[model samples]
Target: MNAERVERIRAALEDAFAPCAVQVADESHRHVGHAGARDGRGHFAVEIVSAAFAGMAPLARHRAVYAALGTLMQTDIHALAIRALTPEEAHAAASRG
Candidate 1:
Protein backbone atom coordinates (compact mmCIF):
# COMPACT_ATOMS: atom_id res chain seq x y z
CA MET A 1 0.00 0.00 0.00
CA ASN A 2 1.29 3.45 -0.79
CA ALA A 3 1.66 5.85 2.08
CA GLU A 4 1.25 8.82 -0.25
CA ARG A 5 -2.05 7.54 -1.53
CA VAL A 6 -3.28 6.91 2.00
CA GLU A 7 -2.37 10.44 2.93
CA ARG A 8 -4.18 11.71 -0.12
CA ILE A 9 -7.32 9.93 0.99
CA ARG A 10 -7.04 11.40 4.45
CA ALA A 11 -6.51 14.84 3.01
CA ALA A 12 -9.49 14.57 0.75
CA LEU A 13 -11.70 13.43 3.60
CA GLU A 14 -10.49 16.21 5.85
CA ASP A 15 -11.13 18.82 3.19
CA ALA A 16 -14.58 17.52 2.48
CA PHE A 17 -15.83 16.77 5.97
CA ALA A 18 -13.70 18.90 8.22
CA PRO A 19 -13.64 15.84 10.42
CA CYS A 20 -12.79 16.12 14.10
CA ALA A 21 -11.10 12.75 13.77
CA VAL A 22 -10.07 10.75 10.75
CA GLN A 23 -8.14 7.56 10.18
CA VAL A 24 -7.15 5.90 6.95
CA ALA A 25 -5.68 2.41 6.89
CA ASP A 26 -4.28 0.62 3.92
CA GLU A 27 -5.47 -3.00 3.99
CA SER A 28 -3.87 -4.03 0.71
CA HIS A 29 -1.37 -6.30 2.45
CA ARG A 30 -4.23 -8.51 3.56
CA HIS A 31 -5.37 -8.81 -0.04
CA VAL A 32 -2.06 -9.72 -1.58
CA GLY A 33 -2.50 -12.05 -4.56
CA HIS A 34 -6.11 -11.00 -4.95
CA ALA A 35 -7.05 -9.94 -8.48
CA GLY A 36 -7.78 -6.37 -7.51
CA ALA A 37 -4.50 -5.99 -5.69
CA ARG A 38 -2.69 -7.35 -8.73
CA ASP A 39 -3.94 -4.36 -10.72
CA GLY A 40 -2.21 -1.90 -8.33
CA ARG A 41 -5.31 -0.33 -6.83
CA GLY A 42 -5.56 -0.50 -3.03
CA HIS A 43 -8.02 -1.46 -0.33
CA PHE A 44 -8.58 1.04 2.42
CA ALA A 45 -10.57 1.53 5.58
CA VAL A 46 -11.66 4.98 6.71
CA GLU A 47 -13.19 6.19 9.95
CA ILE A 48 -14.31 9.79 10.17
CA VAL A 49 -16.18 11.87 12.68
CA SER A 50 -17.63 15.18 11.62
CA ALA A 51 -20.62 17.45 12.10
CA ALA A 52 -21.31 17.03 8.38
CA PHE A 53 -22.55 13.52 9.04
CA ALA A 54 -25.13 14.52 11.63
CA GLY A 55 -28.63 13.18 10.92
CA MET A 56 -27.44 11.26 7.88
CA ALA A 57 -28.42 7.65 7.45
CA PRO A 58 -25.68 5.02 7.33
CA LEU A 59 -25.91 4.61 3.57
CA ALA A 60 -25.97 8.34 3.04
CA ARG A 61 -22.92 8.73 5.19
CA HIS A 62 -21.09 6.19 3.10
CA ARG A 63 -22.17 7.87 -0.10
CA ALA A 64 -20.92 11.18 1.19
CA VAL A 65 -17.55 9.64 1.91
CA TYR A 66 -17.44 8.12 -1.56
CA ALA A 67 -18.29 11.45 -3.07
CA ALA A 68 -15.52 13.07 -1.11
CA LEU A 69 -13.11 10.54 -2.53
CA GLY A 70 -14.22 11.52 -6.06
CA THR A 71 -11.98 10.24 -8.84
CA LEU A 72 -9.69 8.42 -6.44
CA MET A 73 -12.31 5.71 -6.30
CA GLN A 74 -11.88 5.04 -10.01
CA THR A 75 -8.11 5.18 -9.93
CA ASP A 76 -6.11 4.68 -6.74
CA ILE A 77 -8.72 2.88 -4.67
CA HIS A 78 -10.14 -0.53 -5.46
CA ALA A 79 -12.24 -0.93 -2.34
CA LEU A 80 -13.14 1.04 0.75
CA ALA A 81 -14.59 0.30 4.15
CA ILE A 82 -16.09 3.32 5.83
CA ARG A 83 -17.13 4.11 9.37
CA ALA A 84 -18.65 7.57 9.34
CA LEU A 85 -20.11 9.26 12.38
CA THR A 86 -21.27 12.57 13.73
CA PRO A 87 -19.39 14.36 16.51
CA GLU A 88 -21.99 13.33 19.04
CA GLU A 89 -21.73 9.70 18.01
CA ALA A 90 -17.97 9.85 18.28
CA HIS A 91 -18.22 11.33 21.75
CA ALA A 92 -20.60 8.59 22.84
CA ALA A 93 -18.30 5.93 21.45
CA ALA A 94 -15.35 7.40 23.26
CA SER A 95 -17.30 7.53 26.48
CA ARG A 96 -18.26 3.87 26.07
CA GLY A 97 -14.64 2.98 25.60
Candidate 2:
Protein backbone atom coordinates (compact mmCIF):
# COMPACT_ATOMS: atom_id res chain seq x y z
CA MET A 1 0.00 0.00 0.00
CA ASN A 2 1.26 3.45 -0.88
CA ALA A 3 0.71 5.50 2.22
CA GLU A 4 1.97 8.65 0.55
CA ARG A 5 -0.55 8.41 -2.27
CA VAL A 6 -3.35 7.68 0.19
CA GLU A 7 -2.39 10.74 2.19
CA ARG A 8 -2.13 12.78 -0.97
CA ILE A 9 -5.64 11.84 -1.95
CA ARG A 10 -7.01 12.44 1.51
CA ALA A 11 -5.38 15.85 1.69
CA ALA A 12 -6.73 16.84 -1.67
CA LEU A 13 -10.27 15.87 -0.78
CA GLU A 14 -10.16 17.53 2.58
CA ASP A 15 -8.83 20.71 1.06
CA ALA A 16 -11.51 20.73 -1.58
CA PHE A 17 -14.62 19.78 0.35
CA ALA A 18 -13.94 20.01 4.05
CA PRO A 19 -15.90 16.83 4.25
CA CYS A 20 -17.72 15.78 7.40
CA ALA A 21 -16.99 12.22 6.41
CA VAL A 22 -14.46 10.95 3.93
CA GLN A 23 -12.73 7.67 3.44
CA VAL A 24 -10.19 6.82 0.80
CA ALA A 25 -9.30 3.24 0.17
CA ASP A 26 -6.63 1.83 -2.09
CA GLU A 27 -8.15 -1.29 -3.59
CA SER A 28 -5.27 -2.00 -5.92
CA HIS A 29 -4.20 -5.12 -4.10
CA ARG A 30 -7.44 -6.75 -5.18
CA HIS A 31 -6.82 -5.79 -8.77
CA VAL A 32 -3.45 -7.48 -8.90
CA GLY A 33 -2.79 -8.42 -12.55
CA HIS A 34 -5.86 -6.61 -13.87
CA ALA A 35 -5.57 -4.46 -16.99
CA GLY A 36 -5.56 -0.91 -15.63
CA ALA A 37 -3.32 -1.91 -12.75
CA ARG A 38 -0.68 -2.76 -15.33
CA ASP A 39 -0.05 0.96 -15.76
CA GLY A 40 1.37 1.30 -12.22
CA ARG A 41 -1.43 3.64 -11.18
CA GLY A 42 -3.79 2.54 -8.43
CA HIS A 43 -7.56 2.08 -8.16
CA PHE A 44 -9.31 3.88 -5.36
CA ALA A 45 -12.67 4.50 -3.78
CA VAL A 46 -13.83 7.65 -2.01
CA GLU A 47 -16.99 8.30 -0.04
CA ILE A 48 -17.34 11.89 1.06
CA VAL A 49 -20.09 13.85 2.73
CA SER A 50 -19.72 17.57 2.32
CA ALA A 51 -21.70 20.75 1.91
CA ALA A 52 -19.71 21.35 -1.23
CA PHE A 53 -22.09 18.89 -2.81
CA ALA A 54 -25.17 20.46 -1.30
CA GLY A 55 -27.13 21.15 -4.46
CA MET A 56 -25.10 19.33 -7.07
CA ALA A 57 -26.18 16.29 -8.97
CA PRO A 58 -24.14 13.13 -8.76
CA LEU A 59 -22.16 13.73 -11.94
CA ALA A 60 -21.49 17.31 -10.96
CA ARG A 61 -20.30 16.22 -7.55
CA HIS A 62 -17.93 13.74 -9.14
CA ARG A 63 -16.67 16.38 -11.53
CA ALA A 64 -16.03 18.66 -8.60
CA VAL A 65 -13.94 15.97 -6.94
CA TYR A 66 -12.06 15.32 -10.15
CA ALA A 67 -11.37 19.01 -10.55
CA ALA A 68 -10.17 19.28 -6.98
CA LEU A 69 -7.67 16.48 -7.51
CA GLY A 70 -6.56 18.34 -10.65
CA THR A 71 -3.35 16.88 -12.12
CA LEU A 72 -3.40 14.01 -9.65
CA MET A 73 -6.14 12.44 -11.75
CA GLN A 74 -3.72 12.08 -14.61
CA THR A 75 -0.58 11.42 -12.61
CA ASP A 76 -1.80 8.98 -9.97
CA ILE A 77 -5.23 7.48 -10.46
CA HIS A 78 -5.98 4.60 -12.79
CA ALA A 79 -9.62 4.39 -11.71
CA LEU A 80 -11.70 6.00 -8.99
CA ALA A 81 -15.14 5.20 -7.65
CA ILE A 82 -16.78 8.08 -5.87
CA ARG A 83 -19.78 8.39 -3.58
CA ALA A 84 -20.50 11.99 -2.78
CA LEU A 85 -23.31 13.19 -0.54
CA THR A 86 -24.42 16.32 1.21
CA PRO A 87 -24.36 16.44 5.00
CA GLU A 88 -28.14 16.34 5.18
CA GLU A 89 -28.28 13.39 2.87
CA ALA A 90 -25.72 11.58 4.93
CA HIS A 91 -27.58 12.28 8.12
CA ALA A 92 -30.88 11.17 6.67
CA ALA A 93 -29.37 7.96 5.37
CA ALA A 94 -27.90 7.18 8.75
CA SER A 95 -31.21 7.83 10.46
CA ARG A 96 -32.88 5.28 8.22
CA GLY A 97 -30.88 2.55 9.88
Candidate 3:
Protein backbone atom coordinates (compact mmCIF):
# COMPACT_ATOMS: atom_id res chain seq x y z
CA MET A 1 0.00 0.00 0.00
CA ASN A 2 2.70 2.43 1.01
CA ALA A 3 4.81 1.14 -1.85
CA GLU A 4 2.05 1.83 -4.32
CA ARG A 5 1.55 5.36 -3.08
CA VAL A 6 5.27 6.00 -3.21
CA GLU A 7 5.44 4.75 -6.78
CA ARG A 8 2.47 6.82 -7.82
CA ILE A 9 3.86 9.97 -6.24
CA ARG A 10 7.29 9.32 -7.65
CA ALA A 11 5.95 8.80 -11.13
CA ALA A 12 3.81 11.91 -10.95
CA LEU A 13 6.58 14.23 -9.80
CA GLU A 14 9.20 12.61 -11.94
CA ASP A 15 7.10 13.20 -15.02
CA ALA A 16 5.97 16.66 -14.04
CA PHE A 17 8.69 18.34 -12.01
CA ALA A 18 11.78 16.23 -12.49
CA PRO A 19 12.36 16.90 -8.82
CA CYS A 20 15.72 17.25 -7.15
CA ALA A 21 14.38 15.76 -3.93
CA VAL A 22 11.21 13.75 -3.39
CA GLN A 23 10.18 12.27 -0.09
CA VAL A 24 6.86 10.54 0.43
CA ALA A 25 5.94 9.42 3.91
CA ASP A 26 3.00 7.21 4.76
CA GLU A 27 1.49 8.69 7.89
CA SER A 28 -1.44 6.35 8.16
CA HIS A 29 -0.28 5.09 11.51
CA ARG A 30 -0.59 8.56 12.96
CA HIS A 31 -4.31 8.44 12.22
CA VAL A 32 -4.97 4.89 13.30
CA GLY A 33 -8.52 5.65 14.39
CA HIS A 34 -9.12 8.59 12.09
CA ALA A 35 -12.11 8.72 9.79
CA GLY A 36 -10.37 8.35 6.44
CA ALA A 37 -8.20 5.40 7.38
CA ARG A 38 -11.16 3.22 8.34
CA ASP A 39 -11.36 1.89 4.81
CA GLY A 40 -7.62 1.11 4.56
CA ARG A 41 -6.63 3.83 2.14
CA GLY A 42 -3.27 5.55 2.51
CA HIS A 43 -2.63 8.95 4.05
CA PHE A 44 0.57 10.54 2.86
CA ALA A 45 2.87 13.48 3.44
CA VAL A 46 4.96 14.53 0.49
CA GLU A 47 7.96 16.83 0.55
CA ILE A 48 9.23 17.78 -2.83
CA VAL A 49 11.80 20.29 -3.96
CA SER A 50 12.13 20.93 -7.66
CA ALA A 51 13.21 23.51 -10.19
CA ALA A 52 9.89 23.17 -11.98
CA PHE A 53 8.18 25.15 -9.22
CA ALA A 54 10.51 28.17 -9.51
CA GLY A 55 7.98 30.67 -10.82
CA MET A 56 4.77 29.11 -9.57
CA ALA A 57 2.70 30.24 -6.63
CA PRO A 58 2.15 27.86 -3.71
CA LEU A 59 -1.41 27.04 -4.75
CA ALA A 60 -0.36 26.47 -8.32
CA ARG A 61 2.45 24.17 -7.28
CA HIS A 62 0.09 22.17 -5.08
CA ARG A 63 -2.47 21.94 -7.87
CA ALA A 64 0.18 20.81 -10.33
CA VAL A 65 1.22 18.03 -7.98
CA TYR A 66 -2.37 16.99 -7.30
CA ALA A 67 -3.10 16.93 -10.99
CA ALA A 68 -0.12 14.74 -11.53
CA LEU A 69 -1.53 12.21 -9.07
CA GLY A 70 -4.77 11.92 -11.08
CA THR A 71 -7.14 9.03 -10.19
CA LEU A 72 -5.08 7.90 -7.26
CA MET A 73 -6.88 10.47 -5.14
CA GLN A 74 -10.24 8.87 -5.83
CA THR A 75 -9.05 5.32 -5.59
CA ASP A 76 -6.04 4.64 -3.41
CA ILE A 77 -5.40 7.92 -1.66
CA HIS A 78 -7.50 9.47 1.07
CA ALA A 79 -5.44 12.37 2.38
CA LEU A 80 -2.29 14.03 1.07
CA ALA A 81 -0.08 16.49 2.92
CA ILE A 82 2.16 18.38 0.55
CA ARG A 83 5.19 20.57 1.09
CA ALA A 84 6.05 21.51 -2.42
CA LEU A 85 8.69 24.09 -3.14
CA THR A 86 11.35 25.23 -5.56
CA PRO A 87 14.97 24.72 -4.69
CA GLU A 88 15.39 28.35 -3.72
CA GLU A 89 12.40 28.29 -1.43
CA ALA A 90 13.66 25.10 0.18
CA HIS A 91 17.02 26.72 0.77
CA ALA A 92 15.36 29.71 2.37
CA ALA A 93 13.33 27.45 4.62
CA ALA A 94 16.39 25.53 5.66
CA SER A 95 18.28 28.71 6.45
CA ARG A 96 15.39 30.05 8.49
CA GLY A 97 15.62 27.12 10.85
The prediction achieving the highest TM-score against the true structure is: 1
Question: In model 2, what is the error at residue 7, expressed in angstroms?
Answer: 0.6
Candidate 1: segments with Cα more than 4 A from true spot: none
lDDT (Cα) of model 3: 0.87
For lDDT, the strongest prediction is: 1
In the range 1-97, model 1's lDDT, one tens digit per residue, is: 4899999999999999999999999999999999888888999999999999988999999999999999999989999999999999989998999
TM-score-based ranking: 1, 2, 3
Q: Candidate 3, residues 3-97: lDDT per residue as tens digits?
A: 97778878887888899999988888898999889887889899999998888888998899889888887887889999998899889999999
Write candidate 2's Cα lDDT for 1-97 as tens digits.
4678888999999999999999999998989999999988899999999998987999999999999998889888899999999999999999998
- Model 2 lDDT vs. the true structure? 0.91
Q: Which ten residues in a row have the lowest lDDT in candidate 3?
A: 1-10
lDDT minimum window of 10 residues, candidate 1: 1-10
Report how far residue 27 has shifted in candidate 3, in Å.
Answer: 0.2
Off by over 4 Å in 2: none
TM-scores of the candidates are 0.95, 0.94, 0.90
Clash count, candidate 2 = 0
Question: What C-alpha lDDT, on a 0 to 100 scale, does residue 37 get in candidate 3?
Answer: 92
Model 3 residue 32 CA deviation (Å) reads 1.3
- Clashes by residue pair, model 2: none
| lDDT (C-alpha) at residue 74 in model 3 | 82
**Candidate number with the higher TM-score (1 or 3):** 1
lDDT of 1 at 67: 94
